[model samples]
Target: MRRQKKTILLASPRGFCAGVERAIEIVERALQKFGPPVYVRHEIVHNKFVVNELAKKGAIFVDELDEVPKGATVIFSAHGVSKSIKEQAKIQNMFAIDATCPLVTKVHNEASRHHRKGRHTLLIGHAGHPEVEGTMGQVPEGTMTLIETLSDARNFNPPISDGLAFATQTTLSVDDTSEIISILQHRFPEITGPSGEDICYATTNRQNAVKKLAAKTEYFIIVGADNSSNSKRLVEVALKFGAKNAVLIPDANSLKLNELRNVSVVSISSGASVPDILIDEVLKKLDQEFDISIKIESSIKEDVYFNLPPILRTR
Candidate 1:
Protein backbone atom coordinates (compact mmCIF):
# COMPACT_ATOMS: atom_id res chain seq x y z
CA MET A 1 0.00 0.00 0.00
CA ARG A 2 1.24 3.45 -0.90
CA ARG A 3 1.87 5.47 2.23
CA GLN A 4 -0.22 8.61 2.80
CA LYS A 5 1.40 11.96 2.29
CA LYS A 6 1.61 14.34 5.30
CA THR A 7 3.20 17.73 5.82
CA ILE A 8 5.43 18.24 8.88
CA LEU A 9 6.06 21.73 10.20
CA LEU A 10 9.11 21.43 12.43
CA ALA A 11 9.46 24.20 14.94
CA SER A 12 12.99 25.59 15.43
CA PRO A 13 14.28 26.78 18.76
CA ARG A 14 12.39 23.81 20.12
CA GLY A 15 14.91 21.77 22.10
CA PHE A 16 17.64 22.03 24.74
CA CYS A 17 17.98 25.72 25.49
CA ALA A 18 21.43 26.87 26.59
CA GLY A 19 20.53 26.64 30.24
CA VAL A 20 19.48 23.03 29.99
CA GLU A 21 22.53 22.25 27.94
CA ARG A 22 24.77 23.85 30.55
CA ALA A 23 23.00 22.10 33.40
CA ILE A 24 23.31 18.66 31.85
CA GLU A 25 26.93 19.30 31.00
CA ILE A 26 27.65 20.49 34.50
CA VAL A 27 26.68 17.08 35.82
CA GLU A 28 28.70 15.31 33.15
CA ARG A 29 31.74 17.46 33.85
CA ALA A 30 31.29 17.13 37.58
CA LEU A 31 31.27 13.39 37.18
CA GLN A 32 34.43 13.61 35.11
CA LYS A 33 36.11 16.12 37.41
CA PHE A 34 34.92 14.87 40.77
CA GLY A 35 33.71 11.36 39.84
CA PRO A 36 30.07 10.27 40.54
CA PRO A 37 27.96 9.26 43.12
CA VAL A 38 27.68 12.99 42.45
CA TYR A 39 24.41 14.28 43.95
CA VAL A 40 21.82 16.31 42.01
CA ARG A 41 19.15 18.10 44.05
CA HIS A 42 16.51 17.58 41.35
CA GLU A 43 15.96 15.97 37.98
CA ILE A 44 18.51 18.00 36.11
CA VAL A 45 16.08 19.31 33.54
CA HIS A 46 12.72 17.49 33.97
CA ASN A 47 13.33 15.09 31.07
CA LYS A 48 13.20 11.43 31.95
CA PHE A 49 15.53 10.43 29.14
CA VAL A 50 18.06 13.07 30.18
CA VAL A 51 17.80 12.13 33.82
CA ASN A 52 18.11 8.43 33.07
CA GLU A 53 21.10 9.06 30.87
CA LEU A 54 22.76 11.04 33.64
CA ALA A 55 21.82 8.44 36.20
CA LYS A 56 23.56 5.87 34.07
CA LYS A 57 26.60 8.12 34.16
CA GLY A 58 26.63 7.93 37.99
CA ALA A 59 24.71 11.10 38.77
CA ILE A 60 22.46 10.51 41.74
CA PHE A 61 19.37 12.72 41.70
CA VAL A 62 18.14 13.53 45.19
CA ASP A 63 15.06 15.41 46.41
CA GLU A 64 17.06 17.36 49.00
CA LEU A 65 20.47 17.95 50.46
CA ASP A 66 19.76 15.61 53.37
CA GLU A 67 19.82 12.65 50.99
CA VAL A 68 23.40 13.50 50.15
CA PRO A 69 26.28 12.47 52.37
CA LYS A 70 27.97 15.42 53.99
CA GLY A 71 31.01 16.77 52.05
CA ALA A 72 29.82 15.12 48.83
CA THR A 73 29.65 17.22 45.67
CA VAL A 74 26.10 18.32 44.78
CA ILE A 75 24.83 20.06 41.66
CA PHE A 76 21.72 22.22 41.67
CA SER A 77 19.16 21.90 38.89
CA ALA A 78 18.87 24.56 36.21
CA HIS A 79 15.70 25.87 37.86
CA GLY A 80 17.89 27.38 40.61
CA VAL A 81 17.66 26.83 44.34
CA SER A 82 16.69 28.79 47.44
CA LYS A 83 19.30 30.70 49.39
CA SER A 84 18.48 28.34 52.21
CA ILE A 85 19.61 25.37 50.13
CA LYS A 86 23.00 26.99 49.73
CA GLU A 87 23.13 27.74 53.41
CA GLN A 88 22.26 24.15 54.22
CA ALA A 89 24.93 22.87 51.82
CA LYS A 90 27.45 25.10 53.62
CA ILE A 91 26.39 23.80 57.00
CA GLN A 92 26.68 20.22 55.77
CA ASN A 93 30.19 20.84 54.45
CA MET A 94 29.07 19.70 51.00
CA PHE A 95 30.85 20.79 47.86
CA ALA A 96 27.96 22.33 45.91
CA ILE A 97 27.90 23.24 42.23
CA ASP A 98 25.11 25.61 41.27
CA ALA A 99 23.67 24.69 37.89
CA THR A 100 20.90 27.26 37.99
CA CYS A 101 20.42 28.88 34.59
CA PRO A 102 21.87 32.38 34.58
CA LEU A 103 18.56 33.81 33.37
CA VAL A 104 16.73 32.37 36.37
CA THR A 105 19.49 33.75 38.56
CA LYS A 106 18.71 37.14 37.05
CA VAL A 107 15.11 36.89 38.26
CA HIS A 108 16.33 35.91 41.73
CA ASN A 109 18.63 38.89 41.75
CA GLU A 110 15.80 41.21 40.66
CA ALA A 111 13.52 39.84 43.36
CA SER A 112 16.23 40.21 45.97
CA ARG A 113 16.96 43.77 44.86
CA HIS A 114 13.26 44.60 45.04
CA HIS A 115 13.07 43.24 48.56
CA ARG A 116 16.24 45.09 49.52
CA LYS A 117 14.68 48.38 48.38
CA GLY A 118 11.50 47.54 50.31
CA ARG A 119 9.46 46.91 47.13
CA HIS A 120 7.12 43.99 47.47
CA THR A 121 7.55 41.61 44.48
CA LEU A 122 4.63 40.11 42.59
CA LEU A 123 6.10 36.89 41.20
CA ILE A 124 4.21 35.81 38.09
CA GLY A 125 4.36 32.03 37.77
CA HIS A 126 2.66 28.79 38.71
CA ALA A 127 2.79 27.82 42.38
CA GLY A 128 4.56 24.59 43.42
CA HIS A 129 6.83 24.62 40.38
CA PRO A 130 10.42 24.24 41.55
CA GLU A 131 11.35 27.50 39.86
CA VAL A 132 8.51 29.34 41.58
CA GLU A 133 9.36 27.86 44.95
CA GLY A 134 13.01 28.72 44.50
CA THR A 135 12.18 32.27 43.44
CA MET A 136 9.77 32.73 46.33
CA GLY A 137 12.47 31.51 48.68
CA GLN A 138 14.88 34.18 47.42
CA VAL A 139 13.72 36.74 49.95
CA PRO A 140 12.26 36.65 53.41
CA GLU A 141 8.67 35.44 53.75
CA GLY A 142 6.00 38.07 52.94
CA THR A 143 8.47 40.06 50.81
CA MET A 144 7.12 38.46 47.63
CA THR A 145 3.80 36.97 46.60
CA LEU A 146 3.03 34.45 43.87
CA ILE A 147 0.66 35.75 41.16
CA GLU A 148 -0.39 32.84 38.97
CA THR A 149 -3.34 34.33 37.15
CA LEU A 150 -5.09 37.46 36.00
CA SER A 151 -7.44 36.93 38.89
CA ASP A 152 -4.49 36.90 41.22
CA ALA A 153 -3.36 40.14 39.65
CA ARG A 154 -6.74 41.90 39.97
CA ASN A 155 -7.31 40.63 43.47
CA PHE A 156 -3.87 41.55 44.75
CA ASN A 157 -4.08 44.33 47.31
CA PRO A 158 -0.62 44.75 48.68
CA PRO A 159 -0.32 46.20 52.18
CA ILE A 160 1.12 49.18 50.36
CA SER A 161 0.85 49.04 46.57
CA ASP A 162 3.08 52.03 46.00
CA GLY A 163 6.29 50.17 46.80
CA LEU A 164 5.90 47.24 44.42
CA ALA A 165 7.81 45.35 41.74
CA PHE A 166 7.36 42.20 39.65
CA ALA A 167 9.36 39.28 38.23
CA THR A 168 8.40 36.05 36.48
CA GLN A 169 9.50 32.50 35.89
CA THR A 170 11.94 32.16 33.02
CA THR A 171 9.64 29.62 31.38
CA LEU A 172 6.09 30.96 30.89
CA SER A 173 3.57 31.92 28.21
CA VAL A 174 4.55 35.33 26.96
CA ASP A 175 0.99 36.41 26.12
CA ASP A 176 -0.35 35.18 29.43
CA THR A 177 2.41 36.92 31.39
CA SER A 178 1.78 40.13 29.48
CA GLU A 179 -1.90 40.09 30.34
CA ILE A 180 -1.09 39.58 34.01
CA ILE A 181 1.47 42.35 33.89
CA SER A 182 -0.99 44.69 32.23
CA ILE A 183 -3.60 43.96 34.86
CA LEU A 184 -1.17 44.55 37.72
CA GLN A 185 0.05 47.74 36.09
CA HIS A 186 -3.51 49.01 35.73
CA ARG A 187 -4.26 48.22 39.35
CA PHE A 188 -0.96 49.52 40.67
CA PRO A 189 0.63 52.12 38.45
CA GLU A 190 3.84 52.02 40.44
CA ILE A 191 4.57 48.33 39.95
CA THR A 192 8.03 47.86 38.44
CA GLY A 193 9.37 44.97 36.31
CA PRO A 194 12.47 43.62 34.67
CA SER A 195 14.26 45.84 32.18
CA GLY A 196 14.22 42.89 29.78
CA GLU A 197 11.63 40.12 29.46
CA ASP A 198 11.44 37.71 32.39
CA ILE A 199 10.74 34.80 30.07
CA CYS A 200 14.03 33.60 28.57
CA TYR A 201 14.84 34.21 24.91
CA ALA A 202 14.68 30.52 23.97
CA THR A 203 11.21 30.15 25.49
CA THR A 204 9.84 33.25 23.75
CA ASN A 205 11.36 32.24 20.43
CA ARG A 206 10.03 28.68 20.60
CA GLN A 207 6.53 29.86 21.57
CA ASN A 208 6.51 32.47 18.82
CA ALA A 209 7.50 29.87 16.25
CA VAL A 210 4.79 27.53 17.47
CA LYS A 211 2.26 30.36 17.33
CA LYS A 212 3.04 30.89 13.64
CA LEU A 213 2.48 27.23 12.80
CA ALA A 214 -0.42 26.46 15.14
CA ALA A 215 -3.12 28.01 12.97
CA LYS A 216 -1.98 26.07 9.94
CA THR A 217 -1.18 22.69 11.41
CA GLU A 218 -4.08 20.37 12.13
CA TYR A 219 -2.20 18.03 14.45
CA PHE A 220 0.58 19.27 16.70
CA ILE A 221 3.03 16.99 18.52
CA ILE A 222 5.21 18.48 21.23
CA VAL A 223 7.97 16.12 22.36
CA GLY A 224 8.82 16.87 25.98
CA ALA A 225 8.62 15.52 29.51
CA ASP A 226 5.49 15.83 31.67
CA ASN A 227 7.01 18.15 34.27
CA SER A 228 8.50 20.57 31.77
CA SER A 229 6.57 23.85 31.99
CA ASN A 230 7.66 25.14 28.58
CA SER A 231 6.70 21.89 26.89
CA LYS A 232 3.18 21.82 28.35
CA ARG A 233 2.76 25.47 27.49
CA LEU A 234 3.39 24.63 23.85
CA VAL A 235 0.44 22.26 23.85
CA GLU A 236 -1.75 24.99 25.33
CA VAL A 237 -0.48 27.54 22.82
CA ALA A 238 -1.20 25.22 19.92
CA LEU A 239 -4.78 24.61 21.00
CA LYS A 240 -5.32 28.27 21.81
CA PHE A 241 -3.83 29.52 18.55
CA GLY A 242 -5.76 27.06 16.33
CA ALA A 243 -4.33 23.59 16.14
CA LYS A 244 -7.23 21.17 16.07
CA ASN A 245 -5.56 18.60 18.30
CA ALA A 246 -2.37 18.82 20.31
CA VAL A 247 -0.59 16.47 22.65
CA LEU A 248 2.50 16.30 24.87
CA ILE A 249 4.45 13.11 24.45
CA PRO A 250 7.47 12.60 26.70
CA ASP A 251 9.51 11.35 23.79
CA ALA A 252 9.14 10.40 20.17
CA ASN A 253 8.89 6.73 21.13
CA SER A 254 5.67 7.57 22.97
CA LEU A 255 3.98 9.01 19.86
CA LYS A 256 1.03 7.25 18.26
CA LEU A 257 1.31 7.58 14.53
CA ASN A 258 -1.97 5.63 14.10
CA GLU A 259 -3.86 8.60 15.48
CA LEU A 260 -2.18 10.86 12.94
CA ARG A 261 -3.27 8.89 9.88
CA ASN A 262 -6.21 11.17 9.10
CA VAL A 263 -4.18 14.30 9.70
CA SER A 264 -2.45 15.89 6.72
CA VAL A 265 -0.32 18.41 8.61
CA VAL A 266 1.61 18.05 11.87
CA SER A 267 3.71 20.55 13.75
CA ILE A 268 6.54 18.89 15.72
CA SER A 269 8.32 20.60 18.57
CA SER A 270 10.13 19.81 21.83
CA GLY A 271 10.79 21.45 25.19
CA ALA A 272 13.96 23.33 26.01
CA SER A 273 14.90 20.45 28.25
CA VAL A 274 14.57 17.91 25.42
CA PRO A 275 17.24 16.96 22.96
CA ASP A 276 16.67 17.35 19.22
CA ILE A 277 17.18 13.62 18.81
CA LEU A 278 13.67 13.19 20.23
CA ILE A 279 12.22 15.50 17.60
CA ASP A 280 14.24 13.70 14.95
CA GLU A 281 12.83 10.41 16.19
CA VAL A 282 9.31 11.67 15.63
CA LEU A 283 10.27 12.74 12.10
CA LYS A 284 11.92 9.39 11.49
CA LYS A 285 8.91 7.51 12.74
CA LEU A 286 6.54 9.56 10.63
CA ASP A 287 8.77 9.12 7.59
CA GLN A 288 8.79 5.34 8.00
CA GLU A 289 5.01 5.25 8.32
CA PHE A 290 4.10 7.87 5.73
CA ASP A 291 5.28 9.98 2.84
CA ILE A 292 6.18 13.02 4.89
CA SER A 293 7.18 16.46 3.66
CA ILE A 294 8.99 18.37 6.36
CA LYS A 295 9.32 22.15 6.53
CA ILE A 296 11.34 24.07 9.08
CA GLU A 297 9.22 26.83 10.59
CA SER A 298 11.60 29.28 12.17
CA SER A 299 11.14 32.99 12.69
CA ILE A 300 14.31 33.51 14.71
CA LYS A 301 17.81 32.10 14.65
CA GLU A 302 19.08 31.71 18.21
CA ASP A 303 22.73 32.72 18.45
CA VAL A 304 22.74 33.01 22.18
CA TYR A 305 25.16 30.89 24.20
CA PHE A 306 25.60 30.55 27.96
CA ASN A 307 29.09 29.71 29.17
CA LEU A 308 29.40 27.03 31.80
CA PRO A 309 30.26 27.94 35.40
CA PRO A 310 33.65 29.54 36.09
CA ILE A 311 35.39 26.33 37.12
CA LEU A 312 34.34 24.62 33.91
CA ARG A 313 35.40 27.64 31.83
CA THR A 314 39.12 26.86 31.89
CA ARG A 315 38.75 23.59 30.06
Candidate 2:
Protein backbone atom coordinates (compact mmCIF):
# COMPACT_ATOMS: atom_id res chain seq x y z
CA MET A 1 0.00 0.00 0.00
CA ARG A 2 1.35 3.42 -1.00
CA ARG A 3 1.48 5.70 2.03
CA GLN A 4 -0.58 8.90 1.92
CA LYS A 5 0.83 12.05 3.50
CA LYS A 6 -1.07 14.76 5.43
CA THR A 7 -0.10 18.34 6.21
CA ILE A 8 -0.89 20.28 9.42
CA LEU A 9 -0.82 24.04 9.50
CA LEU A 10 -0.64 25.53 12.98
CA ALA A 11 -1.85 29.02 13.59
CA SER A 12 0.44 31.32 15.52
CA PRO A 13 -0.87 33.65 18.23
CA ARG A 14 -3.33 30.96 19.26
CA GLY A 15 -4.08 30.05 22.90
CA PHE A 16 -3.15 31.41 26.34
CA CYS A 17 -4.07 35.04 25.85
CA ALA A 18 -3.04 37.42 28.62
CA GLY A 19 -6.43 37.46 30.38
CA VAL A 20 -6.58 33.68 30.73
CA GLU A 21 -3.00 33.53 31.98
CA ARG A 22 -3.77 36.13 34.62
CA ALA A 23 -6.95 34.39 35.81
CA ILE A 24 -5.20 31.03 36.17
CA GLU A 25 -2.28 32.66 38.01
CA ILE A 26 -4.66 34.36 40.42
CA VAL A 27 -6.07 30.96 41.42
CA GLU A 28 -2.63 29.34 41.78
CA ARG A 29 -1.21 32.27 43.72
CA ALA A 30 -4.25 32.32 45.99
CA LEU A 31 -3.58 28.68 46.71
CA GLN A 32 0.04 29.47 47.49
CA LYS A 33 -0.63 32.59 49.54
CA PHE A 34 -3.75 31.52 51.44
CA GLY A 35 -3.45 27.71 51.50
CA PRO A 36 -5.98 25.09 50.32
CA PRO A 37 -9.76 25.31 49.89
CA VAL A 38 -9.63 28.65 48.11
CA TYR A 39 -13.06 29.23 46.56
CA VAL A 40 -13.55 30.32 42.97
CA ARG A 41 -17.09 31.41 42.11
CA HIS A 42 -16.84 29.97 38.59
CA GLU A 43 -14.33 28.19 36.35
CA ILE A 44 -11.37 30.59 36.32
CA VAL A 45 -11.49 30.26 32.55
CA HIS A 46 -13.76 27.91 30.56
CA ASN A 47 -11.18 25.15 29.99
CA LYS A 48 -11.90 21.88 31.84
CA PHE A 49 -8.23 20.89 31.94
CA VAL A 50 -7.32 24.12 33.65
CA VAL A 51 -10.21 23.81 36.13
CA ASN A 52 -9.39 20.17 36.92
CA GLU A 53 -5.75 21.02 37.55
CA LEU A 54 -6.73 23.86 39.88
CA ALA A 55 -9.20 21.59 41.67
CA LYS A 56 -6.39 19.12 42.34
CA LYS A 57 -4.32 21.92 43.78
CA GLY A 58 -6.95 22.84 46.40
CA ALA A 59 -9.19 25.29 44.57
CA ILE A 60 -12.89 24.75 45.14
CA PHE A 61 -15.44 25.78 42.52
CA VAL A 62 -18.85 27.08 43.60
CA ASP A 63 -21.76 28.72 41.83
CA GLU A 64 -22.56 31.26 44.51
CA LEU A 65 -21.15 33.12 47.47
CA ASP A 66 -23.50 31.23 49.79
CA GLU A 67 -21.49 28.07 49.20
CA VAL A 68 -18.37 29.73 50.58
CA PRO A 69 -18.30 30.00 54.35
CA LYS A 70 -18.07 33.37 55.97
CA GLY A 71 -14.48 34.75 56.19
CA ALA A 72 -13.32 32.24 53.57
CA THR A 73 -11.53 33.54 50.49
CA VAL A 74 -13.46 33.54 47.17
CA ILE A 75 -12.24 34.56 43.74
CA PHE A 76 -14.47 35.78 40.94
CA SER A 77 -14.13 34.17 37.49
CA ALA A 78 -12.51 36.05 34.62
CA HIS A 79 -15.98 36.84 33.27
CA GLY A 80 -16.42 39.46 36.00
CA VAL A 81 -19.34 39.64 38.49
CA SER A 82 -22.36 41.76 39.24
CA LYS A 83 -22.60 44.42 41.95
CA SER A 84 -25.07 42.35 43.98
CA ILE A 85 -22.45 39.60 44.20
CA LYS A 86 -19.99 42.05 45.69
CA GLU A 87 -22.52 43.21 48.26
CA GLN A 88 -23.34 39.62 49.16
CA ALA A 89 -19.67 38.81 49.65
CA LYS A 90 -19.27 41.89 51.83
CA ILE A 91 -22.28 40.96 53.94
CA GLN A 92 -20.87 37.48 54.41
CA ASN A 93 -17.47 38.93 55.30
CA MET A 94 -15.78 36.65 52.77
CA PHE A 95 -12.48 37.84 51.39
CA ALA A 96 -12.94 38.67 47.68
CA ILE A 97 -10.41 38.47 44.87
CA ASP A 98 -11.52 39.59 41.42
CA ALA A 99 -10.13 37.53 38.52
CA THR A 100 -12.08 39.35 35.82
CA CYS A 101 -10.09 40.03 32.64
CA PRO A 102 -9.08 43.66 32.36
CA LEU A 103 -10.69 43.84 28.92
CA VAL A 104 -13.98 42.63 30.38
CA THR A 105 -13.39 45.08 33.21
CA LYS A 106 -13.33 47.84 30.62
CA VAL A 107 -16.85 46.91 29.56
CA HIS A 108 -17.90 46.89 33.22
CA ASN A 109 -16.46 50.36 33.64
CA GLU A 110 -18.32 51.53 30.52
CA ALA A 111 -21.58 50.13 31.84
CA SER A 112 -21.07 51.80 35.20
CA ARG A 113 -20.31 55.11 33.55
CA HIS A 114 -23.46 54.86 31.46
CA HIS A 115 -25.49 53.99 34.54
CA ARG A 116 -24.10 56.98 36.42
CA LYS A 117 -24.96 59.25 33.52
CA GLY A 118 -28.57 57.93 33.58
CA ARG A 119 -28.18 56.21 30.23
CA HIS A 120 -29.86 52.80 30.05
CA THR A 121 -27.07 50.24 29.57
CA LEU A 122 -27.49 47.83 26.66
CA LEU A 123 -25.19 44.85 26.96
CA ILE A 124 -24.46 42.95 23.72
CA GLY A 125 -23.79 39.34 24.74
CA HIS A 126 -25.35 35.92 25.16
CA ALA A 127 -27.73 35.39 28.07
CA GLY A 128 -26.53 33.44 31.13
CA HIS A 129 -22.87 33.69 30.10
CA PRO A 130 -20.68 34.40 33.12
CA GLU A 131 -19.23 37.49 31.47
CA VAL A 132 -22.67 38.93 30.72
CA GLU A 133 -23.94 38.04 34.17
CA GLY A 134 -20.91 39.64 35.78
CA THR A 135 -21.08 42.79 33.67
CA MET A 136 -24.80 43.22 34.28
CA GLY A 137 -24.25 42.53 37.96
CA GLN A 138 -22.03 45.59 38.14
CA VAL A 139 -25.07 47.86 38.37
CA PRO A 140 -28.50 47.92 40.01
CA GLU A 141 -30.98 45.31 38.83
CA GLY A 142 -32.66 46.14 35.48
CA THR A 143 -30.06 48.82 34.74
CA MET A 144 -28.43 46.90 31.88
CA THR A 145 -30.53 45.13 29.24
CA LEU A 146 -29.01 42.14 27.43
CA ILE A 147 -29.11 42.12 23.59
CA GLU A 148 -27.95 38.88 22.02
CA THR A 149 -29.06 39.36 18.43
CA LEU A 150 -29.94 42.04 15.95
CA SER A 151 -33.62 41.39 16.63
CA ASP A 152 -33.07 41.93 20.33
CA ALA A 153 -31.35 45.21 19.61
CA ARG A 154 -34.24 46.34 17.40
CA ASN A 155 -36.95 45.40 19.87
CA PHE A 156 -35.38 46.58 23.10
CA ASN A 157 -37.10 49.31 25.10
CA PRO A 158 -35.92 50.67 28.43
CA PRO A 159 -37.88 52.58 31.05
CA ILE A 160 -36.94 56.04 32.39
CA SER A 161 -34.36 56.85 29.74
CA ASP A 162 -33.90 56.68 26.01
CA GLY A 163 -30.34 57.66 26.80
CA LEU A 164 -28.52 54.48 25.75
CA ALA A 165 -25.01 53.01 25.86
CA PHE A 166 -23.72 49.56 24.94
CA ALA A 167 -20.93 47.08 25.81
CA THR A 168 -20.18 43.51 24.68
CA GLN A 169 -18.70 40.18 25.74
CA THR A 170 -15.01 39.93 24.84
CA THR A 171 -15.48 36.63 23.00
CA LEU A 172 -18.00 37.08 20.15
CA SER A 173 -18.13 36.85 16.35
CA VAL A 174 -16.73 40.11 15.08
CA ASP A 175 -18.95 40.17 11.97
CA ASP A 176 -22.08 39.39 13.96
CA THR A 177 -21.29 41.97 16.62
CA SER A 178 -20.91 44.61 13.95
CA GLU A 179 -24.39 43.80 12.67
CA ILE A 180 -25.87 44.04 16.17
CA ILE A 181 -24.07 47.29 16.83
CA SER A 182 -25.30 48.70 13.56
CA ILE A 183 -28.86 47.80 14.43
CA LEU A 184 -28.53 49.58 17.78
CA GLN A 185 -27.05 52.67 16.15
CA HIS A 186 -29.73 52.69 13.50
CA ARG A 187 -32.54 52.29 16.01
CA PHE A 188 -31.16 54.76 18.51
CA PRO A 189 -29.01 57.31 16.79
CA GLU A 190 -27.72 58.75 20.06
CA ILE A 191 -26.64 55.49 21.72
CA THR A 192 -23.00 55.60 22.88
CA GLY A 193 -20.43 52.82 22.89
CA PRO A 194 -16.85 52.28 23.95
CA SER A 195 -14.13 53.25 21.53
CA GLY A 196 -13.37 50.42 19.00
CA GLU A 197 -16.13 48.15 20.43
CA ASP A 198 -15.95 45.95 23.55
CA ILE A 199 -14.62 42.68 22.04
CA CYS A 200 -11.06 42.18 23.40
CA TYR A 201 -7.87 42.20 21.33
CA ALA A 202 -7.22 38.47 21.80
CA THR A 203 -10.64 37.43 20.52
CA THR A 204 -10.37 39.69 17.50
CA ASN A 205 -6.83 38.63 16.67
CA ARG A 206 -7.43 34.87 16.94
CA GLN A 207 -10.55 35.04 14.81
CA ASN A 208 -8.67 37.09 12.24
CA ALA A 209 -5.86 34.55 12.12
CA VAL A 210 -8.32 31.69 11.64
CA LYS A 211 -10.02 33.56 8.83
CA LYS A 212 -6.65 33.94 7.18
CA LEU A 213 -6.00 30.20 7.42
CA ALA A 214 -9.50 28.99 6.52
CA ALA A 215 -9.30 30.40 3.02
CA LYS A 216 -6.67 27.89 1.95
CA THR A 217 -7.09 24.92 4.28
CA GLU A 218 -9.29 21.90 3.54
CA TYR A 219 -10.18 21.32 7.21
CA PHE A 220 -9.87 23.38 10.36
CA ILE A 221 -9.62 22.42 14.00
CA ILE A 222 -10.01 24.65 17.02
CA VAL A 223 -8.43 23.51 20.29
CA GLY A 224 -10.77 24.53 23.08
CA ALA A 225 -13.15 23.20 25.70
CA ASP A 226 -16.82 22.89 24.72
CA ASN A 227 -17.89 25.61 27.14
CA SER A 228 -15.30 28.08 25.93
CA SER A 229 -16.84 31.03 24.06
CA ASN A 230 -13.73 32.06 22.14
CA SER A 231 -13.11 28.47 21.07
CA LYS A 232 -16.64 28.14 19.73
CA ARG A 233 -16.22 31.40 17.83
CA LEU A 234 -13.12 30.10 16.09
CA VAL A 235 -15.06 27.15 14.69
CA GLU A 236 -17.83 29.43 13.49
CA VAL A 237 -15.32 31.74 11.83
CA ALA A 238 -13.63 28.88 10.01
CA LEU A 239 -16.86 27.56 8.54
CA LYS A 240 -17.90 31.05 7.55
CA PHE A 241 -14.60 31.69 5.81
CA GLY A 242 -14.81 28.70 3.41
CA ALA A 243 -13.17 25.76 5.19
CA LYS A 244 -14.90 22.50 4.15
CA ASN A 245 -15.50 21.74 7.84
CA ALA A 246 -14.43 23.16 11.17
CA VAL A 247 -14.47 21.19 14.39
CA LEU A 248 -13.47 21.89 17.99
CA ILE A 249 -11.37 19.34 19.84
CA PRO A 250 -10.81 19.62 23.57
CA ASP A 251 -7.63 17.56 23.42
CA ALA A 252 -5.90 14.82 21.47
CA ASN A 253 -8.27 12.15 22.73
CA SER A 254 -11.22 13.92 21.20
CA LEU A 255 -9.85 14.03 17.65
CA LYS A 256 -11.49 11.44 15.40
CA LEU A 257 -9.03 9.44 13.28
CA ASN A 258 -11.64 8.40 10.73
CA GLU A 259 -12.58 12.01 9.93
CA LEU A 260 -9.21 12.65 8.35
CA ARG A 261 -9.56 9.69 5.94
CA ASN A 262 -8.68 11.82 2.93
CA VAL A 263 -8.13 15.32 4.29
CA SER A 264 -5.22 17.03 2.57
CA VAL A 265 -4.55 20.23 4.50
CA VAL A 266 -5.65 21.02 8.07
CA SER A 267 -5.47 24.34 9.82
CA ILE A 268 -5.31 24.25 13.64
CA SER A 269 -5.80 26.99 16.20
CA SER A 270 -6.38 26.91 19.93
CA GLY A 271 -8.72 28.88 22.14
CA ALA A 272 -7.18 31.64 24.21
CA SER A 273 -7.23 29.60 27.41
CA VAL A 274 -6.16 26.26 25.88
CA PRO A 275 -2.61 25.04 26.49
CA ASP A 276 -0.23 24.40 23.60
CA ILE A 277 0.34 20.88 24.90
CA LEU A 278 -3.20 20.03 23.85
CA ILE A 279 -2.37 21.08 20.28
CA ASP A 280 0.84 19.05 20.33
CA GLU A 281 -1.07 15.96 21.40
CA VAL A 282 -3.53 16.43 18.56
CA LEU A 283 -0.64 16.69 16.10
CA LYS A 284 0.77 13.43 17.44
CA LYS A 285 -2.59 11.79 17.01
CA LEU A 286 -2.63 12.94 13.41
CA ASP A 287 0.90 11.71 12.84
CA GLN A 288 0.07 8.26 14.18
CA GLU A 289 -2.76 7.92 11.67
CA PHE A 290 -0.88 9.04 8.59
CA ASP A 291 2.48 10.22 7.24
CA ILE A 292 2.38 13.89 8.22
CA SER A 293 4.24 17.11 7.35
CA ILE A 294 3.96 20.26 9.46
CA LYS A 295 3.84 23.94 8.57
CA ILE A 296 3.47 27.12 10.64
CA GLU A 297 1.05 29.73 9.33
CA SER A 298 2.36 32.86 10.99
CA SER A 299 0.36 35.98 11.68
CA ILE A 300 0.43 38.67 14.38
CA LYS A 301 2.77 38.11 17.34
CA GLU A 302 1.15 38.84 20.71
CA ASP A 303 3.15 39.80 23.83
CA VAL A 304 0.47 41.46 25.95
CA TYR A 305 0.78 40.90 29.70
CA PHE A 306 -1.55 41.71 32.59
CA ASN A 307 -0.41 42.23 36.19
CA LEU A 308 -1.76 40.24 39.13
CA PRO A 309 -3.67 41.85 41.97
CA PRO A 310 -1.91 43.63 44.85
CA ILE A 311 -2.17 40.51 46.96
CA LEU A 312 -0.13 38.53 44.45
CA ARG A 313 1.95 41.37 43.03
CA THR A 314 5.64 41.29 43.89
CA ARG A 315 7.09 44.47 45.37
Model 2: pairs clashing at backbone N, Cα or C within 3 Å: 16-272, 82-137, 83-137
Expressed as tens digits, the lDDT of each residue in 164-277 for candidate 1 is 999999999999999999898888877889864599998899899899999998999999888899999999999999999999998767888888989999999888999877
Provide the TM-score for each candidate, comma-separated.
Answer: 0.98, 0.96
Model 2 spans with C-alpha error above 4 angstroms: 158-161
Count of backbone collisions in candidate 2: 3
Off by over 4 Å in 1: none
Error of 2 at 132 (Å): 0.3
Q: What lDDT, from 0 to 1, does candidate 1 have?
A: 0.90
List all candidate RMSDs to the true structure: 1.1, 1.4
* lDDT values for all models: 0.90, 0.89
Candidate 2 C-alpha lDDT tens digits along 164-211: 888889999999999999888888888889765788989999999999
Residue 233 Cα positional deviation in candidate 1, in Å, after optimal superposition: 0.9
